[model samples]
Target: MEKWDVVVVGAGPGGSYAAKTAAELGLKTVFFERGRRPGDKNSSGCGLGQRWWRDFPEIMEALQGLPSVRKVEMVVINLVDENNRLRYRCGTTGSDLCANRWPHGMDGISIYRRDLDPFLADLAVKAGAELRTSTLVSDVIMENGQVKGVRTEKGEPVYAQVVIAADGAMSTMARKSGIRNRWGGGCTLVPQLDFSADPDKMDDVIGNAEWVWFGALYGAYQVNFRDGFHIGAGQWLREDWDEKPTDMVKKVLQFPAFQAMCRAIDAKPREYQAHLLPWLKKPPKTYTGGMMLVGDAAGFPCPLEAEGIWHALTSGKIAAETAAWAISRGDTSERALSEYERRWKASPLGKEHEFGPEFVDLWNSTIFDPKLMARQIQLLLEFSMLHPFSVVFDWGDAHMDCFNQHLEHLLDLAPQFADFGRTYLAPLARGIWPKNVKRILLSVKPRIPVLGKLPDNTFLRLVAKLSKSLAPYLDPAVNQEAPLPREVFERSRKG
Candidate 1:
């Protein structure tokens, strides 16, 4: 029996990052991957958030060297009617739109997992962690009610002081360890297809932009890489739903806008992949005994955007730090490992999960309805396409009357809007005051010429100091329990 300081299941972003950190700390770490190599089985709409550069400079430096990665400068939201006619289109670029929303001053990078995962795993190996590919981890070995190690399908027991489960949403280790019994109603299935085109053609067509399409049969997104595009559609699934995610993918491809985009690029389909993406209503119990879960295993994907890479990397680093601390103290007990959960909850990763259920419910009830969304998009198009000068001077009264009529139509859907406000909007607004304040400050700072030229580090330090100063008041408001909007609405109706 070979003993190691840490054993990580799955060589995805989380597992690789954990291994890298543990190994760098002089801990003997081993990461296992069932795939022939890291990322062989992974699929995503493939946007790596800018937070990675802020948190792990070394990783960002390495990623910059990859030829396949492309910086995303803009994000376009498109809405098309059932007839596949474009109803609304909006695009935003520059610091005002992207940097204010992101913690870092850049949007994100688009990269395929086939390149990213292997690169991350190699980084871990370079940091002195051992990588074992084509190895399936069947179960965690338990002794005296503590996780002792992992047993491979080949019946070999690899012992470790601590085990990090990063085996993704359908985590075998988490289920077998009894940490998670079943997925929640918010679980989504995303079917994705990768297409390759001429690099110049892709750049010309997409212009370093990502596209998100609503008012379609399903929610679809597209990311443009250096020479290819990753496109996918996502839908929340009930346990009883029989239709495959591929069917939804096909439906999305049928949209005229999607078809036109594909035709414009003359994209040749390279691959098709689907994944089970988990969106937990709340954070799950992430640690027990000598075991800690990170990434999708612990349901760390962002509820609003379903962005997994940032959460995966952040949680992986946190788990590794906690494991290292526990090892140094010679206490791998459940109580000691519980610190991982506490520390994560204090971080941004935990805060993002706070409103997960509300976001899911709101989207399912409102934005997910294609007909309602299409109507709203149609009205938005009507408003946007009108010449501003004509509206103000030539047809002022008539245009105003038309706008008021559209408003009335939208108001008729007030029940749905009310449901959203109560369930999602109000709670999110209450919880994110600190974040909103930060965004406002960031937005305002760029207008001061001297202040705008300050280095990224200086700006970040100032932001951190401001956040720390406000934590005393803001933390309580964010964490305080509040009645659900639905409950309040029901009570009001009864009254």
Candidate 2:
């Protein structure tokens, strides 16, 4: 076919979701993948979060029958030291959020792009969108400063009413269609490795939880799958491009934590993959006369975690919604296509990018002060383990004295946490204040900064406060043990 209602480029989450939504909306939709099949050429840590499942019911319903995903029951943030010692471990069970929202009440999920991509693509296909594989869409076809379609590397032209670029960070579709000249310094480099191991052994060693490693490359991850785990790290691209991402990854590969996990699972190298990701603090220009950019093409990856699958899926659906609306109205001009940008900004995904670059980078600054983190973790552990009612194991404790001591400790630490929040996050929260009022607040900060800082801790202490407030209205959640044992999780500690 020479023309279609929409041409969706790239068959990852964004593309597939766009095509699926477009097809379901009675629009002729076709998506192209350069790989031999969907998911064949993609790789990542693949740890989907609570927002991914709880926010999108369609995703959970689709993955319900598939054996492709592993339920994430726990998430542990492993803090390592310069000497390669696992200094402390802090994270929580998904049970903290209650399982009413998650599939089977799991905390999160883990899967490989090899499994996830094809599964999502098949959904698009089943929904009546044509899937064209091994077809490289080299450039977008343009007419009178508007995107008309895409031209394949083989020189064939396919026309469409609207084009959606779901083609990832280094998007040729986005660049060729004039989304922006290039990502330039606004991208991140990530390296990943997949391993194959005995499924039963993997179940024994890793279970269903994912681990986040600090004091590694920027921020690193290790996620469990059915047979093995996926491990990866990310670093922002620099102007000079002095260091190789692989060399940085190699350092992580040699770390005690990485080795401990590998040996525990008898992990055999499955594959090494690297991809560029958009690391912008804000969304870029996403729409033009006849096209819109979704996913990494529009720079939607989280500034801190580099997580963008939800961004892809959500933006893809929104783009298709706009496409369907614009096409129905017979108006595909830039003004009509602008709806795509508007919808995406008002989405849950949009709120993620509100912070500036400095604030986003602050999350990765923990490697600078392991000792400070150690102190904080010690306080948290002491506080959490102080009384049964803290995590609410029981109401039988008459030991209000012990609880009072812990409360005093938290109060002391609260000021320090308040200081950190004021230094880092206050700028991002600036929008909450009017311009003239903001000046007044800043002027008062020098005079009454300490008194006003407690409100800042409200967000950080949300979990503790929420649980206490809801204890009467809600049933106490049953605590579950993490898949990986404490001893096993501590294997990385230097002797």
Best by TM-score: 1
Q: Residue 476 in candidate 1 has what lDDT?
A: 24
Cα error, candidate 1, residue 106 (Å): 2.9
Give the residue spans of candidate 2 off by over 4 A.
64-68, 94-97, 100-106, 356-359, 364-420, 428-495
Please give, for residues 33-125, the per-residue lDDT of candidate 1 as tens digits.
999989988883388766776777667767767878878767888877757777667786575645575455676788878789999899899
Backbone clash count, each prediction separately? 0, 0
**For residues 263-331, could you state the per-residue lDDT of candidate 2 as single tens digits?**
887888887888887878677789998999999888988876777898899899999999999999998
Q: Assess the local accuracy of residue 367 in candidate 1 as a C-alpha lDDT between 0 and 100.
A: 50
Q: Distance (Å) between predicted and true CA of 221, model 2?
A: 0.6
Error of 2 at 378 (Å): 12
For candidate 1, give the lDDT of residue 316. 94
In candidate 1, residue 271 scores what lDDT?
87
Task: Please tell me which predicted candidate would have the highest lDDT against the true structure.
Answer: 1
Give the Cα RMSD of candidate 1.
Answer: 8.4
> What's the true lDDT of residue 177 in model 2?
72
